[model samples]
Structure formats: C-alpha cells, structure tokens
Target: MHHRGFDDSCGLECVENGHDSNKFSLLCSGSAVTYASFSSQNESKAKLASSAAPDSGATKGGSATKIAWEDTFEVAMQRARTEKKPIMIDFYTDWCGVCKQMDADVFPKKDVITESDKWVSIKINAEKRPDVAGAYGVTGYPTIVFAEGTGKPLSVIPGYSPSTEFVGLMREARAKWKPEAAA
Candidate 1:
C-alpha cells in the first residue's frame, strides 16, 4: 500500500507499486519502509484531519455533528447500568477505512445520533483496548456490539453500514435487549 500527501515534517516518501496500483509504500526519513493498504490510507487521512484540526468536525460535505464519546468503557458501562440502557460499543482501529467512513458519514447523521441517544454509546480503539476487544471476540474493524450493562452481547454488526441500515440494526438490538436479563 502506498499513500500520497503525508506531511513534509515526517519526510515520508509515497511510492506507488506497479503490481498493486491501489496499494502504496511509505519510506520514512530512515531506512524504514511501511506498506499501507488502500483502506489504511483513508484511515491515515482521517487521522491527519482529526489531529490537524482537533476542534473541527470537518466532513466531506461540511461540518458534522459530533457524537459525545465516553472517556472510557467503564464509564459507559456505569452509565448504562444506571440509566437502564443497553451499551453500544464501537470497536475500531485507527487504520481502518470503514471505521473512518462511519465516523465521517454514518455516525454524524441525525437519525444515527437520535437513535444512539437511547443507548450508552462508546467508541473504543481496539488497538488501545486489546483486553476489551479480545473479551468481546472482535476480530474485525468497525464492529458494533450491542450489549447489556453487564457486558453480555445481544448483537454484533461487522463492517460499514449505511445510516438507515445502521438505525435498523440499532432497533433490532434494542428490541432484543432485556434489562432484566442482566440481573
């Protein structure tokens, strides 16, 4: 994988491959060479955008409504337990294109935000929180797991989904979740 337009500060050279035109390789200042998939390139772009403008909710079209992400999984779990709402855990990696797409396109939509308000929405970096990711059996990027406050999973959605489809999935999770079952 090769990516273009990395900041000059990093002094990274983007090299295009003949075999896989979609993929690219990044040569750092030193002898280190890193290969990135097409999807990973998108993720890198998203990360750059996020870090460049920390307060800007910049999207493809314009500014987007940001979701109020919880600080930690434990905090979200406690809030869910207290509010009697199911926990919506987003398992994602920084280098996932689909995850970046969801953040930029699907998650900021009005329908998604409104539907998600009923649950304790939490976003976890799978790489950072390997323990939680391992416990939930999350093997893919952009995995949405709906679980009870007690951390029992009711539904798991893998991959990127449109806003309408995502809302339907949320409804199904809500319908299947039983607060009393957590006891």
Candidate 2:
C-alpha cells in the first residue's frame, strides 16, 4: 500500500506503508510511533535513557530534567512501581491538532520536562489503543491522566493546556495522590 507523508505543517514526516502486529508504525522525524511490549527491565531502561534527550531548543543542563517517556502503559506502570513515582499518561491522537501542538510546543519546554521527570511518563495514541483509552474514559484528545504507582488514577485533566498550566495540574495531581486510596 502507498502511504503518503503526513502534513508538513505539522512537523511530522511519514512515508509509512502499513501496520506491524497490533501496533501502528509511522516513520516520523524525532517521534516514536511503535507500541510493542518491552522484553526486559534492562532493555526498557536503556530505551528510556536513550530517548530522554532534551529537545533541540533546550538550553544547557536541560537534559538533566528531560522526561523519559515509556513505550507502553504497562512499562510506565512497572517503572512507576519500581521508582515509586506517579504515572502520567498522555492520551493523544495523531490527527488531533491540539495533541500535535502539545507535542511540538508544550512538552518540549524546559519546565514541563523538568517537572515531568518526577513521574513515569507514557504517551498513548488514543485512536490506536482504543481499549486503553476507553478504560480511562478518554473522550477527547490530549487527556492527561495522573495515577499512582499501582495504576490507580489520581486525576484526569482533559483538553490542551499550556506548559505552565500543565505543570501546575501535574503538581496538583501529585499533591492529591493518596496511596491508601489506591488500596
């Protein structure tokens, strides 16, 4: 099948051909579109570390605060449990403009990256992972779900938010997280 490139205005370049297994594959510049299960803890860690580089616009020392996004929700949950940090799931769709804006403009900011480092970050394509999206009741694009290390949700913020606002929401969610409530 012939796959045309995504809109250049969106800053995504894809010459995709087809899907692989249950995961959708798109070759985009500086973006990941695979959702395969991780084989081992070491492999997962290596992947996370390698992909945690600061965005090109980031200044010196920004890499230290970069958020390491997991490839899958399960991996994020496992990492959260192991690291005793909260899980922040970013539910987005490739076609959602706001989602793309968040990816391009908001998430790359230094503050957002620094604050997000405290959590186990996971980006899920809602359209590709309908089951997971439905389970979280995500009806819109760019839904940010904050949960405990055990995967029990703490707060759900819907719609697109600027980097500062998003960080504030994250802080509020973290403050409200109750470990006992998850049990």
Q: Which candidate gets the maximum TM-score versus the true structure?
A: 1
Give the residue spans of candidate 1 off by over 4 A. 1-65
Mark the 10 consecutive residues where model 1 has the least summed lDDT.
53-62
The candidate maximizing lDDT is: 1
Clashing pairs in 2: none
lDDT of 1 by residue, 1-183 (tens): 443456565444556666767555555453323344444555545443553211123222122355556768998888888878898898887765556767766787888877777778788888999999999988776788999988999998876567887899999999999987644
- Please report how far candidate 2 places residue 127 from its true position, in Å: 1.5
Model 1, position 59, has a per-residue lDDT of: 29
The lDDT for every candidate, in the order shown, is: 0.70, 0.65
| Residues 61-91 of candidate 2: C-alpha lDDT, one tens digit per residue | 2256456677778877777777778889988
